[model samples]
Target: MKLAQRTALVTGAGSGIGRAIALCFAREGAAVAVNDIRRDRAEAVAQEIRALGRETLTLPADVSDSVEVRAIFEQLTAQWQRLDILVNNAGIVELEPSRQQRLIQAHMERLAGSGAPAPLAISQSITDMEWRRTLAVHLDGTFYCTREALKLMEAQRYGKIINMASVAGLTGLAGAAAYSAAKAGIIGLTKAIAREAIHCGVYVNAIAPGFIDTPMLAEMDAEMKRLIALQAPIGRFGTPEEVAAVALHLASDDSSYTVGQVLSPNGGFYM
Candidate 1:
């Protein structure tokens, strides 16, 4: 009941880490706003929260869409007039092949004779579009939601913002150029905001998770899993509940003095 009587908004709460955090908040007596792009998934989480006798609101919207983000915030404001916590956890990843540069060069040559848009490929490094889109969802979404939440928090002089980053933010991960950059941006942004919000009684922080047993991990092949497990000193993937534990601490008064810090839940991966 650490979050009793609090109001929290958790983006991407339909599944994985986001869903786990939303449920944890609800179980601890917080009224939660569960948001996700998928209406069915969001509703399902909300229903589960309600079943636990906790207050819940299911808001379906794409975090990248400013219009939808505004509408969702407005609805929350109308209902509670204030927010105690905001968690930005929605993200996407694109794995470009290592030989992308050579492939792009070949494609460009083949398209030279055709009067069509160049058959561009994401460079061996990564494509601008991929980077932009990744940043839009992870960094931009965090910015938009935090911006809106701050308005309410500033007035009350109280709030907590827990951004979801990744170990990729701290260290480069092969083939995850866009995701790595976007998450790194989140960590930097969290620190800046935390410094600014200190005087106003608001704390901003981020959690950098390592390999977790989420839906995303489920999608990985056995070899990928083996490689990831080997990377973690613990030799196994972490769980959503483990990450949720740190999130709960940051969202509550227990972490009042902790600001502008990126707490890593990784199992000795970056240490």
Candidate 2:
């Protein structure tokens, strides 16, 4: 009951790491608000939270939309009137088939001892819409949600904000320039806001997880998945529950002294 009587809002709680975190908080005695672009998915997670005997609020909204985000906070205030935790976990990844095919071919060439460098023109291949959408979802969505959460948190003089980053942000990943940039921006935003919000008793931190076995990875072919798992020193992809454990720590009083820090759950992937 580390979070007894507390309240939390987790974006992207429909599935994967976000859903795990929502359930973890609920188990710890927090009334959870589940948010996802898909209403059915949000409701599904909300149903799980209710089964745990915790109050649940299902919020279906695209975080990238400022209007929608504001409406979400308004609903939160009307329902609970307080927000103790905010997890900005909603994100999306876009990789064109042509780009991925090119990357795969280059990888195969290198494996065949071609000696020639792989021309990963990921940046050049990114469509304007893809670039903007990636940032809009990860970076802009985080900001929109955080801005609304801060109003509630700062007023209460107590809050925990956790931003989900990635190892790709720390050690840039090939073929994912937009995603890397978005995550890197989140890290920067987390630090800057952590410094500003700490004075108001609102602690902000980030979690940069490595390859986690989430739906996000479902797009990768089996071979690509195997290769990625081996990339981690742990020799396997991390689980959603593993990342949720870290989120729980940051959400609770255990991380009282930790602020403006990027707590990476990367299993020896990027040092």
Candidate 3:
């Protein structure tokens, strides 16, 4: 019951890491807000939380949209009057290099045929749209939620914000330029907010996960899976529960003195 009587909002709670965090928070005695773009999935998580005798709110919205974000917060504010914790864990990944390239090329070709002048060829390094969307969902979404949540947190002079980053943010991957750049931005933003919030009794921190056996990792090929397993010092991918445990620690009083730190549950991949 580390989070007893607290209220928490978690984005991307439909499945994977986000769902795990939502469930963990609820089990620890928090009134959980489970948000996801898919209505059914979000409600499913909410239903499970209720079955556990925890108060829950199911909010379905795209975090990238400002209007929906504002509405979600308004509902939360009206219900709880205060938000104790905010976990920005919603994310998407693009893993297939060849298919990604082809998709980008086809999109450009379509736009060109539609009479919109075609831009330059898509760069193998990173396409403009990919960079934009990555930043929008990861970096921009974090900023939007943190900014909105801080207003309420500041009033109470007590709050915790846990952002989900990744090892790719710390170490670049060949085909993950956009994702890596966005996550790197999150690390920088987390530090900046932590400094400002410390004076007001708020803590802002991030978690950089590596090769978690979530749905995202399941999309990888056998070769990629073998490579990741071989690379990890523990010789296995981490589980969503393992990463969620660290998030729970950060969100609770146990991490009262910890701020602006990126906790990596990466199984010694980088170290």
Candidate 4:
């Protein structure tokens, strides 16, 4: 009940890390608003929160769309009157499956010293659409939601904003140029907002988790996944629940003195 009486909104709450964070907050006594671009998924998570005996709201909107984002805040404000926590966790890996598979295969071959001498050309392979969509969802979505959440939190002089970044943002992934760029942008955004939001008693921070056992990585073939897991000293992928624990800390008073920091749960992958 560390979060008793607090209200939280978790974007992308339908699945993976976002879903874990929403449920974690609910278990700790926060009334949670679940947001997912997929309305059905949003409703599903909201139902779970209701079962937890905590208040719940379902927000179905594309965070990349400013208009949709604004409407989401309006509905939240109308229903809850105030918000204490916001998790900017909506994101996507927009690379085509075929392209992603090829890239992964190429990387493996390269590691074995058997691939083509040329680079993967991943940056050159990115279409304008892929680059824009990646940034729109990861970077722009964070900005729009943060702006709206600030409106309510600023008035109350207290809030917690947890932005989801990635290990790719810190040590760029070889073939995920767009995702790496977008996450790096989010890290920059978190830092900038933290400096400003702290003035109003709002704590802003980021969680850059390592490869987690989520649907995102479920797309990878078993061999690729195995190799990635071994990249971490822990010799395994992280769990969404594990990442949610960090989110819980940031959203509660436990992190009162923590601000503008990127707390990574990468199992020594980067450090």
lDDT for each residue of candidate 3 in 18-124, tens digit (9 for 90 to 100): 99999999999999999898899899999999998999999998898888999999999998899999999988887765644544555557857866544433346
Q: Where in model 3 is the C-alpha error above 4 Å? A: 97-125
Q: TM-score of each candidate?
A: 0.89, 0.97, 0.90, 0.96
Clashes of each: 0, 0, 0, 0
As for model 1, its CA RMSD to the true structure in angstroms is: 7.0
Q: Per-candidate RMSD vs. true structure? A: 7.0, 1.2, 7.4, 1.5
Which parts of model 1 have CA positions greater than 4 angstroms off? 95-125
The 10-residue segment of model 3 with minimum total lDDT is 116-125
Clashing pairs in 2: none
Clashes (candidate 3): 0
Report the C-alpha lDDT of model 1 over 168-229, residue by residue, as the tens digit: 99996755767888899999999999999878999999999998888865546555567668
Ranking by lDDT: 2, 4, 3, 1
**Number of the top TM-score candidate:** 2
Q: Compared to the true structure, candidate 4 yields what TM-score?
A: 0.96
Q: How accurate is candidate 2 locally (lDDT)?
A: 0.93
Residue 36 error for model 3, in Å?
0.8
